[model samples]
Target: MIINGVSVGPYQLGWRLQELEEKISISGFVEEELDKHYTITTNTLKFWVEKEQGEITQITVFGEYEGKFLGKIGVGNRLSDLNDLDIKWIKEDYVYKLPDYPGICFELEDIDDWDELLAPIEFISIYCS
Candidate 1:
């Protein structure tokens, strides 16, 4: 299913996962003293495509098992951090434009805890001509 122009499920563009336990640690919801859980995830991919009127498409993916913690999060977070390591400007044809390049964006569980550590994450939006 598609929600807010973002895709869902295995074929979607977004995901959240943790290979090891206690890595993407999440507290506050585990007051019940839960033990363990399983999670899988992917990064955010926002790119532009010819949608008849220059529409932007974004995709996100995430999944996890439930164990009664933090009210249940679809996917565990590695400290709720995101990264945009390698990025480059996207060209419509042969020219580059402002606001049309890849940018770093962070999706934090709590904006209050978001800091420089999350700088690696970002979002890329298309600039209007």
Candidate 2:
């Protein structure tokens, strides 16, 4: 999977909900709605999409996703793996973000142990900066 600030794999931020549905259909993936977001599930990946006015505003990847963000960071990577970057924690969401990189954030398995080197990432969220 190729991930950038604006996109995850082929799913780009700001894509229309209909466009995403078409791609999901072509890939034979299943989609489900939960609360305010929609989830797309494939055999090895699960991602959530939140939209506004029919356009995707955020894309969050979790649950067995095997791809890396920017081919470097990923769900299983430890918190220490990001030590070289300027990472900030968002208390309200229990997620971390890099000040230099907009539109992306990471959720760890244990937010309380966020400073622990072994804390593993649980989710990767991409959105509009």
Candidate 3:
């Protein structure tokens, strides 16, 4: 998905906060000082800004962009939703990590106490180190 004209991907690693603001218009952010980070939340996505080097390191898409979510998966989609993608996923409990795609992770939320049923996606995180 595209955030402020820059797509949410590894290429966003070196993007400055102002540059992003220029593109998406920074309304406000929850400032985090420990690591010079900031979280900008929009109606559709959450941007995690890392300022150690004055750049954005990660982005979490909360819902569909335009008409697709991660190429078909949406916020409430379950693990089975990813069946169409030709990705080899590594599962650890409810979290799925893609080995082929660095800085990308999908987490499922266990709404019920039972873990037998498929869980809906809580969030999708894309990072750049």
Candidate 4:
């Protein structure tokens, strides 16, 4: 089957919708990226993210399938799957909402890695605020 993303296509939205295993997960290829992203409704691009300030990264979730709830989990599933299940966003404050077509994305923040741990600790604190 073909795969489609906010960026990738072929299957586009239709094929992606089929990947839903009653659950779906969005994981970052790198630790510095937004680790978690999920939607509460169809056509809803808003997603909640797991943020890392220090050496940590990503805000993620694991969703499961339930016929009645029509909910989707992140565990044991891939971002490429969506057909069999509806996105069930875990309720949170940092809900990621997309403002543009395809979706609103983040501009990765730049940082300098220091040999000392203090730099990371201080950086994480700033984000926590």
* Estimated TM-score for each candidate: 0.21, 0.73, 0.71, 0.17
Model 4's TM-score against the true structure: 0.17
Query: Which one wins by lDDT: 1 or 3?
Result: 3
* Each prediction's whole-model lDDT (CA): 0.27, 0.71, 0.62, 0.22
Task: Write the residue-wise lDDT of candidate 1 on 56-105 in tens digits.
Answer: 23333222322211222223322222122222223344222223223211
Give lDDT tens digits, candidate 3, residues 39-84: 7676666777775776777777665533234456556766666664
Candidate topping lDDT: 2
lDDT value for model 1: 0.27
After superposition, the stretches of candidate 3 with alpha carbons farther than 4 Å from their true spots are 2-6, 9-11, 26-34, 63-70, 84-86, 92-94
| Pairs that clash in candidate 2 | none
Looking at candidate 2, the ten consecutive residues that score lowest on lDDT are 84-93
* Residue 35 local lDDT, model 2: 80
TM-score of candidate 3 to 2 decimals: 0.71
On lDDT, who's better, 2 or 3?
2
- Candidate 2 deviant stretches above 4 angstroms: 2-4, 26-52, 84-93, 111-115
RMSD of each: 16.1, 3.4, 4.1, 18.0
Worst 10 residues of 4 by lDDT: 120-129
